[model samples]
Target: MAGRLLLIWRLLVRDLRRHRTETLLLLLAITAATATLTLGLTLHELVARPYEQTRAATAGPDLVVQAGQPGPHSLDALAPLTTLPGVTNHSGPYPLAFLALTAGDTTARVVVEGRDGTPAAVDRPAVTDGTWIRPGGVVVERTFADALGVHVGDTVSVAGHPLGVTGFAVTAARPAYPRAGWHLPGSILTEGGGLVWVERGDIATLAGEQPLSYTVNLRLADPQAGAAVIDPSGGDARFRGWRFSTGQEIADTNGRLNAPAQQALMIGSWLLTALAVVGVAGIVAGRAIGQRRRVGLLKAVGAGPAMIAAVHLAEYLVIALAAAGTGLAVGWLAAPPLFRPTAGLLGSVGMHPPPLRMVAAATALALTIAVAATLAPVLRAAATDTTHALADAAVPPRRRRWVISLSRRLPIALLIGVRINARRPRRAWLVTVNTLITTTALAAALMALAQERSPVDLGYSKLPDARDERTTQAMILVVCVVCFLALLNTVVSTWTAVLSTRHPLAVTRVLGATPAQAGVGLAVAQLLPAIPGVAAGLLLGILTFFAGDDNQHAPASWMLTAGLGVPLAVVALTAIPAVAAARRPVADTLQAGVR
Candidate 1:
């Protein structure tokens, strides 16, 4: 006569212990979500801090001015801006060039920040690799060295002039156009980053030829120096203008400039969040199904619906909280790279830890997504009639006359598919939604790549060198990989769900349906819902381009491939798993599903 609440708690705890695999998966899901949010919030800070420290110790300037023509006028033009009300100090008239350099067996690119002085602290590069740039030597960006697998003592040639990499150093400046965007600049641009520090006297000889291509850099005394100049056009005409950067400004700017990388961070965050939703919910639903029959016995004993719902929902709450906390802790440790961009960018403006609000927001978002995704299945179980729920071992659908009639008239596989789909509409919807997310992500990534390579609004290609192109391409490859994995997981999850209906499937197999017929039936069950899902996903991929983006137009080939390819790939992936699962003995399957 005692209440079932205690029984429910005991049962829930027992299930948690018994399902170690499910619990681990739940932990992984939450961990990924937590890591992504933490990374998104903290990347700039992590990347920018060391650079800021280096910048402060050295005389790194605040603003960089680049000109199409390196001439006296460029220098003359900067003279007045330094005299602006808030403007204080200045550093260059430094000549910078981005060139593809070949060093022995390795062919790569180097960014040359040609200066007229020794490496300093206020505006200097701290020589970490070797000595500072002497009359004949150059300093390399440490990351660039890490990429090329070169060392401080190695030699790198730019435009035929081979110079020893005197030292590996960190600077206080970085361009959005090159590598080091906290945004995942893909692998190519992200790699091969080099800075050749040429002596003031050797500029002409090192450059191959230079009247000095036009560039002026300024170092502002205050943080607010060129704040108003972000818009670009409103500044003085003769000055074509230089943009001033602060340590914090560097981090924020890096985020904005690296579109693909930032998108990656954002997508990764949302993706993990979505996966956690599906993963946690699946485990919840599976448990709820088991609990449903027992709850029916309780309902017959006059147990209240509210109590039933609370008991089931409470188990999820505990799991979710544990997941959230564990995930946050993992993210806290794993996400420093995401918060700060590249070293140089960070040093231009100091990086700071985000306020407590970001952490609070991350927790809230994870909880909401997890709780909402699980509630539907739990609520459905709670609402079912006690007798109907308890009597059937494998619950039948309410009604699917349309599916039954169409199946009766169709090919064996098609008919089987239609019926299977109708039997479990939720699974079908899940497959469609998962497919949509992958395709949309791929589409968005492809479009991002196109933007980086072309940057239409700015006309000139974002990077004019092979190294830059390579970095962007690397990012695309990751997009492709991520999409493939998400799609693959969906196929696996679908197969697992289908195996839960072995009894019904066994009946079909026993009804003179050949093994091939049974297989087709299984395939159809997956494909019927997939057709719409793929079509819709393709539409979403295209629409996403025109959505909030620059109204960019993609070649039809990309759209078709992304849209159609995703669904087909998913369907194809399911084939092997479905076949393997379906091939098991009909008797065993029937017995298990009924149990």
Candidate 2:
């Protein structure tokens, strides 16, 4: 038993050292998969935990009532809500007015709130920087301040009235900016703006009797029952164009601010995971074919099938373990950049370690992909007959009259490549799958980026929906990484193919096939499979993205271009490696072919 274990260990170490580049590529593929999965699985917890903490710290309101009327006493309409059932406490009838804020080169539409110098009982704004609203100063909302790059002591023109920035504050009375305005169900607001606070004494200076809306933050005994009690009529039956927001809804809004980005992360992660599996599988298959002689040698030395298989599998297991660790660390670091601090809280939230279940799941997936792809090839290689293994020979080709007849009609180089592919159809399929995964991810990303409307395009400088733009950016990131890795896989797979076909290619070269022709033949083999793969990937991308999207718009023509371009790019990428292999000394290759 000890001797068998020692042999396996020696084989494992030797193989790993001999194939350092292949091992590195394998690690990167697995790392990408696990890192993306970790981010996708834990996004909810990352976004929600900090929001809940912020909500608790700010004493966020249970219900927010917006009363709009064309009069100075518009707040009087909401006075009746103070007497409503389940309304345990109330904060305001604070003045709400819309105005333009100009800060240097930037101009933004802002909703200004009038508050007293004293803090409220229901919804308290947590001041992150500077001081609260002073007599002649304005407190900018955190998100708004961040967007405008304005800090304390800077003067901002609010409704054309210049005021010194006193501090940055965040409130739970509404979901941050852009969404600060009331959005009717199924009806997006034509315009959205951010929020700011000023002392009651300064309200008249900016508002000037422009018929402000009055908002009251209410604390309820049963916060969840807000919709039932607050909006009984479900229409303007309560107040003219009035809206009500429940506490739980506000919490959800804050927590799901990055819903679009999180969605992209999840979708991209799954696609990348599938690609990772294909890449590792291809590498394993290629490695197994290349190492047939090694397998035969082990068998001749009296090593059992179990010991040979263990040696091959152990190499991947170590790489898988290392990949998982690298991925976890990357995911942890990557998550922080996705979530930026908003006005509601002063400090950035520290990244809490993901739950044990998430780490376990990610690690298990990485291992499964590594082990599963190689298992079949390992078993097959281990079971090889000693005679064939020692001779380093393939099984006799089945005689096909049609193949011989067809070869005469094709160019010599293409004929040679076609014959090679016919011998190893499974390898061709693996390459096809790799291109398919890459194209599909690229298509999805292009579609996502196209659908996203930037905040500036919508005529708002600082809206809460800015998170949606961030989501699109994340999708682009995923696309770039997936495509890059796919390119690397192409290079590696080509190199492996060259190694496998050296002797056959050399014979063709000796028989008068030019190096360029040999290179074209090799590239054609990859291209033949790519045609079907590209088409399938396009369809797959369309179905995946459209099925998940609420909008049913047809994909643009450019998307097709991007999808079809991937396979072409892969064919082109194989050229250098193929040419390099073709130009290798024919005499040496033919000599090496002999057992």
Candidate 3:
């Protein structure tokens, strides 16, 4: 068995060396797939730690209770419940007041939790950049600090109070929400509204001297017991209740109150990974014909079909390992940054290395892609007889021959491109599938951009200052990336297609067609089948929105235009590469193809 394996390795290495291009592509693909998985899975554990720590420290409450209307006692009543079965220690029938703050023309609504005077309490927030809250000073969540461009000692006004910014900190308490990669939730902070720490006397007067409301934070005897308390409370606010969130949920949500961004990023990773797998599969199958002569030769020798297949498959496995390894590293590095844009939303101000599980999962995905893409062709090569495989060189009959015959009287360029493309329908199909995958990726990216639900200050939606800028940034990123990939794929596809079909194009030239005409003909062929593909992709995208949100199904004119324009753009973009490849010295290309 060892000797057989060695022999297969030798054969695979030799073939892999011969097909360096495909081997390189396999490496690139594995790297991409691995990177995406690692980033998606590990983001919370690695990148979201600061936010988690901040959330835990500030909230110190096991269940934060609130009142529907303003009354201080609704919070005080929770004291007896803590004395109930699972509960033990508790703090703060503390005042949590929400207020709208105005700093010059900029305004923000802030969620404020009254802090206990002591620094070392169980739910205490640790100071990060400056002194803790003094009688007249407040501490702001570090993430929010970074956003509001405020620091310790920088003063801002909230609800007409001139507050002293005494500190920047992370608390298990009040801070900005966490956001997924798809969006950012804008945040505003101050001394409890700039770090305005009012000695107890000023609290009610500053809060509009407003009607008072309060809530308590309890620390359970067993932290897990807190969840049991939370579940039963969901149905009614009559006991007027509290919902308990787990460490992980809190960590996840630490990035945002509603983690739409994280969910979007995860889905985006999965969707792109699927498209990459499909594209690679098409490319692998397209290369199978090119390997036929080699397959036949190996079979003709005493080598069994199994060894031949093993050799082909093993080549991919070797590359997959390297690619997966590389991709995992890239994912680890990228994950931290991916979360950077939304860090303020999470309330975290620290960075953590990704957990081991995220790296392992990503590597597995990369190998899966390589195996899934290459398995069929490798197996097919092994299953064939030597003579039959070797003798499989009969001229591929012209596809849709009758149709081409009928169109022969048409313009030279269209006739030639159609005839050649028809002869190798599978290659045309490979190109088409590649195009579709590109379209799918572009669409997913655009959707991510368009659907961003980043957080903003509550009730500030109608405010002049509130802007969903992240969504705009995401849109520009998606468009730029899609355009670049579209241009890149168009050129490469045309060049590869033209090179693969050069013999036919050369023959057309021999039969009396201009080189320019032949080149244009190649573009025509790609454009024809691509029409339906682009249209279908557009319809799918539009339907996706409708399916995802029945209300969003309103007819969109731009989608239709983009869908129609993609194929036309593909054809136009392809012309330069096709023309360049076509103008290559015909005799030289024919000689190369012959060899």
The candidate that achieves the highest TM-score relative to the unseen native structure: 2
- Model 1: per-residue Cα lDDT over 426-471, one tens digit each: 7777666666666666776666555544421111112244233433
The residue pairs in collision within model 2 are 142-343
> Please, what is the TM-score per model?
0.69, 0.82, 0.79
Model 2 Cα lDDT, one tens digit per residue, 329-424: 787667767655244443333356667887798789889888877888889888889878878885665657887788768987678777877866
Best by lDDT: 2
Q: Give candidate 1's root-mean-square deviation (CA, Å).
A: 7.5
- Give the range where candidate 3 is weakest over 10 consecutive residues by summed lDDT: 180-189
lDDT score, candidate 2, position 245: 81
- Model 3: lDDT of residue 95: 58
lDDT of each: 0.59, 0.76, 0.58
Total clashing residue pairs per candidate?
44, 1, 32
